[model samples]
Target: MIWKEARNLYVNKWILFEAIEAYSEDGKRIVKDLSVINAYDDGKEALKEYREKHKKDKSREMYVYHTKNDELIIEERMWMGVRKNG
Candidate 1:
């Protein structure tokens, strides 16, 4: 879901997630279309849960952000690519 939708749904909460996306032919994932993995309340308990989950798989793209910051969340992106030799 988009951050705006998520914000309306999860007010005063923190969301932790890894995006579900499609990969390109060159093996790069397209992040514009992302599905949230884990959604948790923003609290000490949630922090503990995030820590445990993050430790198990460090490669997972995880983020802890508040619903209030919808703009920031929506704009966030991870750039991944290697420059080709000329």
Candidate 2:
């Protein structure tokens, strides 16, 4: 489903979804098509679930977001190098 449709369906809730079709534009991720995995009352819970799922299958594009936002404005970042602990 689209972001608008998902927002309508799950109001004032945290949703964990997988981006089926998406693209990066202007340093932001624009999800064109998505599938809702689950809905949660808390953002932390949604994030925890997202982490687990992501760890299991790194290939899948998943995100946790609240429905209160009008649009999905995910900022894209580029990681330059690996972090080293001293």
Top lDDT: which candidate number? 2
- Kindly report which residue stretches of model 1 are placed more than 4 angstroms away from their true locations once superposed: 21-31, 37-41, 73-86
In terms of TM-score, which candidate is strongest? 2
30-55 per-residue lDDT for model 2 (tens digits): 99999999999999999999999999
Pull out the clashing pairs in model 1.
none
Residues 65-86, model 1: lDDT tens digits: 6776746333434779998999
List the candidates' TM-scores in order: 0.56, 0.91
State the weakest 10-residue window (summed lDDT) of model 1: 22-31
Root-mean-square deviation of every model: 8.2, 1.8
lDDT of 1: 0.62
Worst 10 residues of 2 by lDDT: 70-79
